[model samples]
Target chain A: MFLPMVLNSLNPLLKETFVNELLKCNERTKDYGLVLTPEGAESIIEARNNILNSLGRVDMGIEVALGLIENFYTSTFINEENYVSVLNEFQEIFYYMKNETEDMISDDKLICIIKDYYENLCGGSLELLKSCLEEFIHDFRRKAHTAEAGLGGEE
Target chain B: MEQRDNSGQTLAVQSKINSTNLKKSQYTIALLNESFRVGLMSREEINNIQIQIMQILKELIARYTKGESSSVCAYTAESILNSILYCIDAYALGCDSPEEAICHLKSLQISKLYERGVKSVSRWLEEARELYKKVRKNKLNVGLESYDHTINEDIPLYFTNCGIVFDAHNGAASIDYQLTFDDMSINGILYMKNYLEHLWIENAFCKYFNSEDIEKLLSDFGRTIGMDYKIELINIFELVFNNAVFAILAGIPEGLRISQYHFDLLSGKLKALDDSEIDKYICQTVEKLVKNMNICELNILDYIYRYKTVFTQRVIRLVRIDSLRGIILTEKEEIKKGYTILFENGKEMKIEDFNLFIKKLMKLKNTEDKIALIKSGIESLNDFVDLLASDCLFGKEFEALFNELGDMELAILAKMALYEEIRSDFRGLRSVISEKKESRVEWHICFVEFLKKSGIDRIESIERLLGEIDYTEISFY
Candidate 1:
């Protein structure tokens, strides 16, 4: 609670530095021949809002979540043209997963799971990543259903 | 209470005075307790009100005892309680102050305060609470958004105890607003409150209806309920309320008709209610609902229009009669068998002559007939037009016959025959049929005007060709 207020008061200074640092990093990362750019910040903000609204959550793990987003996009095959849309779709998946798991799975764990799927099983396919997220939600729901049944409860 | 007259003579107070004829104040407190039980008075406020009333009696007694006043007024337990109720209602209706409300209540010419204040106001308040509870907490768990799918967002329905106040989050701008009830106008409060109860009633009615029927009904009313339309929530409530009341009073089994199939359905649902009370409640509720709509400046036209089918169907059910509009469709099926006309020469002509004449006109196979009719002059055409105006033609057949009359003079003559000519014996049927014929004539004239506008001026049998074109197909716009 205190952190957002403190960060909000310092947002103007932080935003200027943050944008400059992002651009500077983009410039250096070009040497490593990655097509990443600093155009996906809007997508991150939208994602943050969707998660916060749907889960009724504060910005506890939002920055780390955003950081995880930036890391995946920079290393993946997403270019400037499709990065915003791809990030938005990912945000939808993340929001849906959080609610489906009843927030039992932390944001860090979700991000880690997505990263592993993206690099290994999915091979950088957004479609495959979505299906993986759906499977995770289905599993979570099944387990919840089983638990309810065991407890003699109806949902 | 004991009092003294101006002459220093002791007087007996009415209301079972004991010993020296002092009136007892016991019934005053008893009335307050009864008011508390009926929910007109809160526990905290009851004692204070009882004391204040007793204080008024005491001051009057003291003035008379000192011989400052000539007379003291007698107040029974019933009369005192009536005044308290009047004050309570007036205050609840947003008086400037309780004192002002009480002062205003005293001036009203209330003959029977027992019926007006205690019984009527208590029932209204009770019904208001039940409706508010049903809308906000809905025991069925069925939401308002169930019937209105255009409400995309899941907004919670809110109600406060201040008398049938329903608050809604209007989808636009996410603003929460209450459809205000004019507390001073009892009908206005009841009108808004009954809407909430009607929502619950509709949910129950839906159980008897097939899913497809509900879909068709909703689609028919889609213009008002659809997303693009932003009807005020109160208007939506009115629409639902009107439909629900009609459904319960007389079930609508088909479009614009109340069939007996669903009457038992409504009766079954209302089986819990006392049979005698049901009819009384229906009359009173319907009367009040209609009265509120009539007296207030509120425009329920959109609501009435959206649910016109059910509204008209219920009215038709209650009156047990088909409207003139229904007769137009009935005429499409067959001709009136006994509709024969007597000429000036006392010769009766059967309707088949007119039918055959129209059929020949349609086939354009009777140039000689037209010549013969012309030779016979205006009298012959008048007879033909009179038969035509009897509304013996279907919409398509009417158009076809009128179009077959290639003369514009003949068409104008047909218009006159339908509107001006009258038959006294079949008065009701003639008026209805004449009105319908007038509408068909207007449509013919409109289509002819369209043809003239489109530079198709010299065509033969324009009405015939226009009749071939569907009503939806012909658009002057």
Candidate 2:
């Protein structure tokens, strides 16, 4: 489904030949592991509808909530190998911020680590993380353009 | 009490556990992916394809980790995470737009990175099981060694009882190190607990089965010679446990299945091993028995019976009847079949009776009185036997066996069904009796038993006939 759309966008002539075929294929929408099956798609729609109705976020555009994934991983996670020692220090400094379970793993330590990185480090702050994510489609378009050129060169 | 088939309940619980394990494994994966959606993939599962994407990103982070900003293609790393996060958020909100994109990478065998906390507990469980076997094999009973201060030396037991509160206020990051062994998750702790539980259940079942496995192991081993030590036997068990790996591996002494038969054979070979070959096999068979002693026919009771002197010299032990697991010379044919001890004084004690008497005394309110009666019965009988054990003149040798009463018993037995029979029941008269009694072997035995059962103390008819035969000097006792 994605392939035909990209091909049609790049070449208007390809649309007439590939678009119908691809749309027909997407109707069944089945694959072994890819999970683009008819059942999976239906589940996605049902879940989305549920979220929209329950959270009252039906009006929220896809773009509005798009950047969260980047914020979570790079900023929040502690590297496992360095965690034991680092977590201990993180725990002590963030002692007041700790919840019961977090006594072993300090939340304040996570905040402190992030703050420490912000003050001491450069280039990959949360702001930079978010910025990197925001440029994704534009960068993708550029890569696609170069990829097309490489295909032409082979021809 | 009505019996419900709880077997189904056990199966249902097992299935639920399996389903939970799968869910936890997946949840852990999703939790990790949340991290990779950020600008650069966090270094998580090194072999993972998503981590490979971050490996390229790490080329960029190397500069950051080392305090130097290395010039890199910002657009290349930036857009992937951007699209990924965009898709993730849309996915979270039930939007298919960005997910459509992230799904592409995932289908291409890509997995997003997660923090170390989001680990597959199953791995540790597998590791712990492996380690336990290794430790047992190494003879490290319970303590863990190697350079000490182990990072993982069992969980902080006191702090183990923790309640999970997925506080939405703290957002999801609060979940990082909140360790939980989902009853469903194949965590090491759970596996360990199961291992212990299975052991307990198996031991219980074995107890009920009378450790038929013990007898079976012994029987399969056939006959072994020489001493087996306890420690070596433990080592053998560790080997078996490590190797067998499943309950089914240790099977019935004799099984129809080819594989089981083979296992029993091999196990027997190990057990029945001669002292010439190996010293101890992990079993604690007769520890008190001498190392080089000729201990044949492993039936504990039989051994105790035949070699009472040797056994008493070794240790005062009891060989529990039903549940017997011993390394004997051969399978005991009639351990419970019971024996009848015929005294020279004409009394017979059945094995079953002796066993019953012992059990009865065990339950009696006054064991001393019951014991005294038993002792007196045995002593009186023994004294009568000792008198015969000394000499032979009793025809008087015959009198010692049947006693003076034997002649009387025969006379009464002979006249039992005859119109004018001459046989007598009295010992003195029975010797001279001529009339034939019941001829069948079984009938004769039954007649003898009937005389005892009838409680007729003397054979008067036989006594009169014997007096006519001029045996006036002889008397029926």
Candidate 3:
């Protein structure tokens, strides 16, 4: 249910695999999202422009600053209506996360919280999503580390 | 896929959907509805429905943002916004369970973009439409030849009913490279680089100006006028235009409608320097250029030739409107909201109907008020002559405190910003771009200010209706 509505009509078989892929993507997003300390988001955002020419992961360093989210707006892009709704949610979520960085939560718990959000708001689809999340986390971690090294060189 | 480990937080969301017979999942979205319904949902319930929709969107994003799908570079600002919406709509219409929803959203979204791309080329069509109207007014017929033929048969903005006509008809090109430096030489970047160079003086002035070829023209003009129009010897910069002149103009590929702002900036840059002050001026111009242009454009070793230009064909003509009113940052002719009013004829006419127009303009709540004001001003605008006729009133003493009607912002505020920056950074040169140019108006100001600044003679005869607004350095392009 937390899945963005833009991708709502899933074929029965592909649904089984897609859930896993999405979970993988989420993990990567999370890993990338938690690299920057809250204060570093601006610098990271500024760095995004520089990213045009190079493979350096300066933008990844920004998420490292944001850290993990317990209850944030869905990161899903969907139909116009849903897109707007989710954007509003993220606006609040990002603001709130920026305001409260000292507080931390476990990865599994965060995922569970996200699932709960989906269930209540739309409906529920948890297992397939979780299966794919680990891959996303791996990719995100790798990228974040690369960006961290880049930050070291700049200083 | 494994079960979600749920020893976390849990809450039971109350069914805000009060009516039992109505399917709660069938959320009524006001904007998305087929315009036929007159049904209304309470504000709170509407919000809940939207939140549910957002959750569906979140899931869709999860479904497709994998593989080489989201990696497409042709994506645009609108696309990013649209794709998110597309998936959500697919979700809303589907009866499939969560697993099946992902694939459907992904396939549908891509298909829509693919299908729409064929027709969504309305961007140029819209541009063509605007151009058609402008061309009709100006009575111009021009055509563009893009190398690629795909852009052909593309319904342009101008309409002949059978086919859309475009002012400039062309397509993108993929060309075979003719170079020694590999594929980098084949980049379609010359146009882009040229564009950036226009707005940012540092980027293009020297490149275009310092060329031996350009020097010949400048020297010739100088000899002809009995005064040097150095053109590019001095430093330069611009605001509102991209970092460089070329870069800024690049955004609007069509020829630009030149304004006082563009001229003012050019004058501030290429105006002649006195022989005695030449060295100081050179230092200042160089300093300003360094601070503003993209230093990366040229190799450091090519300093001598990087900016050198043999100025030729690209002839620029300028005329500046000087005033202390609402001319600052004026990208277009109409003055600021609080300062001046423009009529259909492109002239500022606020003095006669100032109070009533302003009071109504201030309370402008919707389209009707704005339209009414526009009509009233346009209908009998004999009181306000357009800037094209300013020549008629030249050499007159006018009592209008909000001087100059044409869109020029280089008056006081511009002087102030330039003064502050130059004094701190390029101070030794006496910070002159803001200084009055060689003009009869400056002669009058010099005569007046000389009397005021040092108890001498003033414009002793205060004649009726002679343009009293006197400022030195008014540009004549």
Superposed Cα deviation of residue B295, candidate 3 (Å): 40
Scored against the native two-chain complex, candidate 3 gets a DockQ of 0.02
Docking quality level of the chain pair in candidate 3: incorrect
Model 1, global lDDT: 0.40
Chain A TM-score per model, please list them: 0.60, 0.22, 0.24
- Give a tens-digit lDDT track for model 3, residues B343-413: 22224456556445545554655544444554465422233322212222222221121232222221222
Query: What is the per-residue lDDT of model 1 for residues B364-412, given as tens digits with 9 covering 90 to 100?
Result: 4354554444235323444554545544343444444444454443323
Among all candidates shown, the one with the greatest lDDT = 1
Each prediction's fraction of true contacts recovered: 0.00, 0.00, 0.00
The stretch of ten residues in a row with the least summed lDDT in candidate 1 chain B is B326-335
> How do the candidates rank by lDDT, highest first?
1, 2, 3
By descending DockQ, how would the candidates be arranged?
3, 2, 1
lDDT of 2 by residue, B1-477 (tens): 121122321111221122222222233234345424432223433135444334333443333224221211233224323323222222232312222222333333333322111132223344445654443333312111210112133222211321111110111111111111113332223334333333332222223222334443332222121111111122122212222221222432321112444445545554444542322332222232212223343332232233334322222121222111221222322223122222233353455664555455445445345435444544223333332232311222222234323443344333332312322122232332333355444333344443343323454444433222212222212
Q: Rank the candidates by TM-score, best first.
A: 1, 3, 2
Per-model TM-score, in order, reads: 0.22, 0.17, 0.20
Residue B111, candidate 3: Cα error in Å is 9.5
